[model samples]
Target: MLHPILPLILFAFVATATPGIATTLSTASGAQFGFRRSVPLMIGSAAGLATVTGAAAAGLAGLLLAMPSLQLAMKIAGSLYLLWLALKIGRAGPPNLDVTMAKPNSFFGGAGIQWMNPKGWAMGLGAAASFAALADGPGQLALLLGSTFGLTAAVSLSLWCVAGMVLARLLKTEWQWRALNIVLALVLAASIIPMWRTV
Candidate 1:
């Protein structure tokens, strides 16, 4: 079956291009650890989002949506985790913000976060609902969603990471670095509001 590949690519691009929890994490990791060390974060983010989108395509999202209590619990848990991350990121410095800190936001961290990310859920559910029908079967739909979103996410997040790396070079002072961290943390924390309001 011809899988509307072009339209799927376009849709995936738009969804992944928008800044969200994953992008924010990518940018933060890049700024803190530089592009090379942060590669895992970007890759894991792409993979995690792909998994989420694929699972949603496989009917997990629908099951969650039908369970109001479970969904609310997930939202609360996700919000708390994001807030904790924001607090930690907000407290940045010179020596303290080294590549060693990368452990917290390594590949596993990036992938784990997406499971609780509202933006990931939004995009995954949206894509599953919008594009799943075009697929020939559940397995094919999951594969299509995963592959398309994964590739687009990789590119989009790499750009975000690069942007953060560039911005880091411009920072001459500790205060400037701290300020950027604070701003990123705030934006990441703030990302929850819009999605929370809808729920």
Candidate 2:
């Protein structure tokens, strides 16, 4: 049973670390506002993922699966939100050299993204489903899964933010910042492919 969970932990790490809307936004925030300002968003993302994990362990995924229409509605709503985020990222201006002037991604925005993120739902549900039988009770299973997800999400988001900070130094000019923002926005938009397939 422990052995099975080891693999799941690894999967969680990879899934969280991979570039997604959350990571992209974290990176963007870090580039624009630096690490300190991005902490709230990172914490919010972890909290949001923890909530998803808890929901999955409590059988919310099963409920969603049973109601195909509801699931479809959620997917559509999530996709639209992602597109809107992409648009915002695309239009974002160059980073303000003065930290005081920088407008970073907010805690609520980060949490809201995870709440409506289809990938987050899939990952949480998949993890819970894969590990359900290993635990003795729903509560125990939820605690384990939620802790694992929250830890991984926090670490992964921080790494992405650090990477963005590094990249921020390289983007010395407005054009470079604008170009990178566009690329990140495109990546965010492309992330909708998985959700579209489910639709």
Candidate 3:
């Protein structure tokens, strides 16, 4: 029981810390708008992940899994949204850097991405399932999982954003900036494919 509980925390940390859609968005936002402006994105993403964890403990993740069609629909929807975001990120750079021209990714946008992603759903469900420490109470499970993921997500995403900020300093020209954005956008788009490959 102790082993299971301890491992779950490590799982949550590593899973959230791994670069994914949310972190990609954070990186792009940090590069484009700097850390202060990217704070909302970080917070929103963490909130969104917390929601997913709580809902999984609440049983919505089981409902999604029981209905394959609904799950597929969600995956498709999330992928489409990410693709659209990738396009927007790719197109935005120094020429499009005017804050008025292209505002940073918003709080809601970050949350929405988490809500829609299959990877998030999968992680939530996995964490919520049959853990010994949480055997006596679902509420306890949700609280623990949500809090763990949320904290890990915030720290992980902020690091990625900081990495993006650091990368920004290396860009000596508009073209370099644009190229970096394009590369990030491409990686973000590519990230979606792995979740579906197993399906």
Best lDDT among the predictions, by candidate number:
3
lDDT (CA) per prediction: 0.80, 0.81, 0.82
TM-score of candidate 2 against the unseen true structure: 0.89
**Residue lDDT tens for model 3, 1-199:** 5565677777877898787888899888888888998998899999999999878876788888889898788889989989998888888766345443277777888888888887787788878774535656777777888887888899999999999898887887988988987898999999998768633
Instruction: Provide C-alpha RMSD values for all models, in order.
Output: 2.3, 2.6, 2.4
- Clashing residue pairs, candidate 3? none
Stretches of candidate 3 off by over 4 Å are: 1-6, 95-101, 130-132
- What TM-score would candidate 3 get against the native? 0.90
Clashing pairs in 2: none
lDDT of 1 by residue, 1-199 (tens): 4556778899899888887787888888777877888888888888998998888888788777788787777778888888888887788664355432444477877787777765676677788778766788888899989989999999999999999888888887889888898899999998877657644
Task: Give, for candidate 1, the lowest lDDT window spanning 10 residues.
Answer: 95-104
Name the runs in model 2 displaced over 4 angstroms. 1-4, 97-102
> TM-scores, in order shown?
0.90, 0.89, 0.90
Q: How many residue pairs clash in each candidate?
A: 0, 0, 0
Candidate 3 lDDT at 164 equals: 86
lDDT of 2: 0.81
